[model samples]
Structure formats: structure tokens, C-alpha cells
Target: MRFLSGREAVLKHIFETDDEAPLTPVAVTVTVTREGRTTAATSGTAIRNGDVYTFAAGSLPLGVYTVRWDGGTAAVDTSWFEVVGGHLFTVAEVRAYDADLSADRFPTSAVVRLRDYIAGEFESITGRSFVTRCRRIPVELDGSCSPLPLVDVQATTFEDSAGQTVYAVSVEPVGPFTLAEGEGSYTAELTYGFRSVPDDVKRAALLRIRTLLFAERSGIPDRATSFQPAEGGTYTLATPGVRGSETGIPDVDAVLGRYGFDVLDDLAGVLL
Candidate 1:
């Protein structure tokens, strides 16, 4: 399940015994963790409502959080939830992209789902996340120190293999820089990714969603690789078959190509 940031995160759990009977424990407690760090561990009992135990986790920051419930009688359970800022595109933006789209015909929920689906597809193609979040990445020191495999990194901190804070490390905007002293492996806590989706990326998503909506409404195949016209010309789509990166739409692919690995490598001057 997912919740928006700064919203009350009410977690619920139901405990059952071997015979599928609702078993109310003597005491219940909740613990929350994010990015391997414990943010909240409550000793207070969770509110019980019949067989369901609910814990008010309060407003949490943006990230995937893990919740553990200890029922004190070995009735422990774990669950996870994510808190996000918002979707990549808004329904209004979608409607603005295509003036023909009307809420009465398309519906807001459907547009939201399509936007989310396209955002996921965009990430899958680029192997890059657009949401701003903290990530712990393992880095190896090899004297020459290659750039980290990320972009738009905001800030970073380093810790050695033993998890002790390492002060001898430096960084370039997107990756870990040369270490002044130690070698081997280290963990870099990077606060990276774009705070807002780029305009080009949003356009790409909008274009893909338009194609999907068209196919769904008109009953035409989504992606047509090849089509022959009666006028006698055989046309082939310029879909890059490398790991399913291309979307088979020329305009969408054009926008994505600007952010592809090849372009990133060209800008960084280092093959990644």
C-alpha cells in the first residue's frame, strides 16, 4: 500500500491462530524502518478493534517504509508501504496534452493509472529514477575512481565497510570522488534524482499515454512494427530492440533518446 507524504499512516494487521481463529494478543507494538534505519519503535500498545490491530504511524517522510508488529506471543508480522509526492503527470496535464480528451469520457482514475504505467515504463527503459529520494549505494575504490552509476545526484555522505562514518571521501555532483586514504568497499548515502520530472520526460509520458488511449478507444493495435500500404511502400518502425528501450513511437523515442545511456555517456565522457 502507498500513502502520500505528510499524511497519517494508519497501519492495520489481523492476527489468527492455527485454527483460523482471531487471537488477540496480550500486547502489541509497532516499529517502522526506512533505508535500513529505524525511524520509529513504539512500546505503546496498538489500538485493538476486534481482531484487527491498528497502529498510527503518524506522518512519514517520502520513502518505502517497513513495518513490524510484535504481538508479544510470537505473532509477529511484517509489511511495507511507500510514501510518494505525486504522480509524474496530472490528469489536467493529460487533458491539456490532448484537447479531445474529456473527463466524462476518459475519467480521472483511468488517466492516473495510465500516467503511472507510463512513468514505470519510462523508468524501465532508462534504468533511472525520477523521484527525489535517498539511496544507499555500494562503491569500490580503485584509485582512478569512476563516476557513480547515477545522475542528478543532490548530496552524498560516505561510510566505510564497518558502517563507520568515513571523512576521507569526496564526490563530484553525480558520483563518489577519489578517496584520500582508505581503499576497498564503502557505502555512499546519496540524496539524488530529480525533484520534478523534466519537461521532455513528461512529454514522452504524455505521448505514450495518448497512444495507449487511442489504441484502447479505437481498437487498433498499440505498436505496429511494420505496415504495408496499398500504394506499394513497405514501412518499418525505428524501434530500437536493445533490451526494449524504444517505445516504437518516433516522437516519444526522440525524447527518450536524449536521456538514454549513450547520451549520458557522451556528456560524462566516460563509458558507464
Candidate 2:
């Protein structure tokens, strides 16, 4: 997408007035796809640009990706851009993600989350049948320092206001996040997604989730944590009473229905 200078913001620690902030995302992850299949995507850091919220591409897959940030208002702009192998990303098309929607109906993370939580609660509460595509992908860190290289969907790709590159990782998928719920009768496409990453990139994303579970801090941001380094193709997260490695990441069932959808929230919990 051809993002106007004011249409998006660089993925960095944006300093803005609280009331001026778009929305505080507890956790977010990058999700993308190409050629009707999944790609190697990545994400990093949270950022905001005035009223415009933009997420730059990270060290994700090589191909054309329709990128957009998905944590703020549905009124937030989403544009389409193309990624090449030996060149920087190019914008092919530019338009608002939800420009046509009524101002009153623009979707936000909270609005989406509340709807999903209610649907799930409704199903569980009254057995009305809840439809969702949430699943956990276990992970293993390998072939890197105890610390994983950074990967991201757009954070790294977007140059900061200072015009310096952020070393976070990135991801590009074969497609976008999906939803098949009958109530809404609508699905979200993978225009583009964003995520925060550490310095280690060799670690497969699945293992990244396990790192969040067994390590310290939180996974929503996927911030770095203290862990014991292991030999060859693996990293470890351990403590006095507990220790673990990428070899055996566990999968926890869907505990909450965020946004009546699973793609972003599920992965968000796993990565953060």
C-alpha cells in the first residue's frame, strides 16, 4: 500500500498523550501469508503515530504482503504493499482498512474481544454452539544463542521516527487470520500483522510460545526473559523450582474466546 506520511507510524516506543493514544494492546503478534499458503513471518514492538497507527514489516517471508496493523480502531488505516527478495518492500495499493464502515460500527480489539467472550460464554452457558478456529502451536528454540534473534510482522520493517532500524524479527504468512462464526457471518483477512520479538531468530515461532509459558514476564509483548542456555539448536527457560527447554513445549486449550476469533488472541497469548 502507498502509505501517506501521516497514514502510519513507525513501530517504536511512541510517546504520546494517553488520551491521544489509539488503544493499549495487552498483547499482539504478526500474522501473514502468501500464495494461498503460510509464510515465515515476524513482529516487534508496539507503536503509534498520532491518529494513524502503522506496523512496519519485520524479517518475515519474501513475497507480496498486504500489511496493516490490527489493534486500534476499525477506522485505523490498512494499506497493501509488496515485499521482494533483494529489495525493500514496495507499496502497490493504499486504502483504508475499514474506511467504508460506519463510524459507529468500526471494529476495535476490545469490541471484537467482548463479542467473542460473550459468544463463548453463551455457548458454554447455554450450549448454543460456538464456532472458533483457535489452536496452540508448540515451539522449540534452536541453532541460536540462548537468546533468539528478533522476527516480526511489520515492526522491524517500518523505520522508526529517527530513521534507524529496529532489530526485531518478522513473519509473513500464506494467508491471513480467519473467522467462521455464523453469528457475525464475517471473517477477517490477513492484510498485515505486527509482533514484538527478541534478538534470537533461529528459534521457530512455536517454541517461542513455550518460551513465554516457561519463562518470566509476559507473552503478550514476547519480551526477553532470563533463561539458562543449552548446547546446540535449543534454549532453556528455568528457575529454582522449575526448568524447561524448547524440546517439550506444552499446548494449553482455549481458556478464553477473544474477539469471537482465535488467530490474533490465541497466538498473542502464546507469544507474549
Candidate 3:
């Protein structure tokens, strides 16, 4: 299961005996862990509601969390959940696109998985980062103009080899337009990536997600091909798979075509 960050996570488990009857243990305990570190734990009979045990894990940061339920039974039930800062599309947005979709028929977890999958696929196909990030990168300056091999550059601060801020540097639309009067190595505190994802990109992602869901629920393989005989021709229908930089969906492919670029194109053949 997955949840957005800053949202409370409610974990529940049903206890049953070997005879297929409700079994309420004398006591139940819940433990929440992240990266093998226990973050929260609770033990008591207060957590039990009849045969159902629940633990309300408070708002957690972005990361995977494991939940363990110890009901004094011979077996320990374990489950996992994830928290993300944001997604390209929200569950509400996805449901808006498909009016027939409902929480009962299609859960939010399934939708989150599909959204995450499409987001990753879009980034991989376009060779671009959609999430804003900051990092320190090594750069070589020739005392003049030097292009920073990064995309969607928002801001940068250049520092000399000794890690001192270089005041004699100016950032241009493309990269560092000017640098200090010397040839040497420098580090750049670069902040880059999109503040908001493109509308068309989100639309393409929605379409692809819808296609996948429809195929899955209808028992149809996405890659399955069928041929129909017409009065004067044969029509072949098939779903396109990801090839090269294409997503196989017409609208998706069109959107990606506008943003996709070869690695060489991104670097402009600059070795650095």
C-alpha cells in the first residue's frame, strides 16, 4: 500500500483461528519500522476492536515502512507501505478521467502503483527529471565560459577549488556565462528540474494508465494483437510496446517526442 506524505496511515489486520472463526487474542502489539529501524510501537488490548486489530501510524516521511502485528499467535503478520512526497497525477485526477472508476472497484493503492510506473516510464523515455532536486557537481572552468551539463537549470552557485564561493561568476540561461580568471576545478551547487510537470505530459500519463487498467480488468493482454476482415481490407489492431524512446501510445508518443532527447544532445558532446 502507498500513501502521500504528511497523511496518517491506518494499518489493520484480521485475526482468525484455524477453524475459520474470529479469534481475539488477549493482547495485540504493532510495530512500525523503516529501513530496519523501529520508529513506533504499541502494545495493549486497546488496539483490538473485536477480532480486528488496527494501528494508526501517524504522518510519516517519504520512505517505505514495514508493519508487524503480533497477536500472541504462532505466526507474525507483516506488511509494507510507502510514503511519497508527490505524484505526477493524483487519485482524484485519475478518477476524474474515468468516471466509472470507484474506490470499491479500484483501490487507491492500485492507482498509485500505476501512476508511479507511468511517471518512471515518462522520465526514462524523455531523459529528463520531473522532480526538483539540488546537488553539488564538479565542473572544470577555463577562466571563461563553461557549460554546465545539466537540464532545466534553475540556479547555481559556483565555488573555487578550495570550496570558497567564487564571486566573479555569472550564470546564463544555458550555464555559467563567466567565471573567475583562472583555469581549475570548481564545484557548483546546482538546483534544477521542473517546478511543475507539463499538462500534456500528465494527460499522456493518464491515458496510458487508463489503457493499462482497462486491459488488466478486462482480461486482455496489452500486447495482444487481433485481425478483423473488412469488405475490402484486413484491419490489424495491436498495442504498441515501449521501443527506443516511444511509449507506444499515439498521444503519449507525441508528448514524449517534444521533450525526449538523446544523451549526447543533452551534453552537446561535451566530455564533462
Best by lDDT: 1
Which candidate wins on TM-score?
Answer: 1
Better of 1 and 2 by lDDT: 1
Summed backbone clashes in each candidate are 0, 56, 0
> Candidate 1 versus the native: TM-score?
0.64
Per-residue lDDT of model 2, residues 121-154, tens digit only: 3334222222221111212323221111211122
Question: CA shift at 138, candidate 3, in angstroms?
Answer: 18
Per-residue CA lDDT of candidate 1, range 139-254, in tens?
88675545665666676677886778887766654232222234568887776566788888887788888877776675434466666777899876555574454777778877
Candidate models: Cα lDDT each: 0.69, 0.30, 0.67
**Residue-wise lDDT of candidate 3 within 1-272, one digit each (tens)?**
65666688777777656799767776777788763244463333327777778778878754567777776654467777766555677899989998877788779878877877776687777766564444467877777665666667676777776667886666666331222244577777766556677788778888988887776675544565544445666544434553433655677788888886675554554434
The candidate 2 region of ten consecutive residues with least summed lDDT is: 86-95
Residue 100 in model 1: shift from native, Å? Answer: 6.3
Better of 2 and 3 by TM-score: 3
TM-score of each: 0.64, 0.21, 0.57
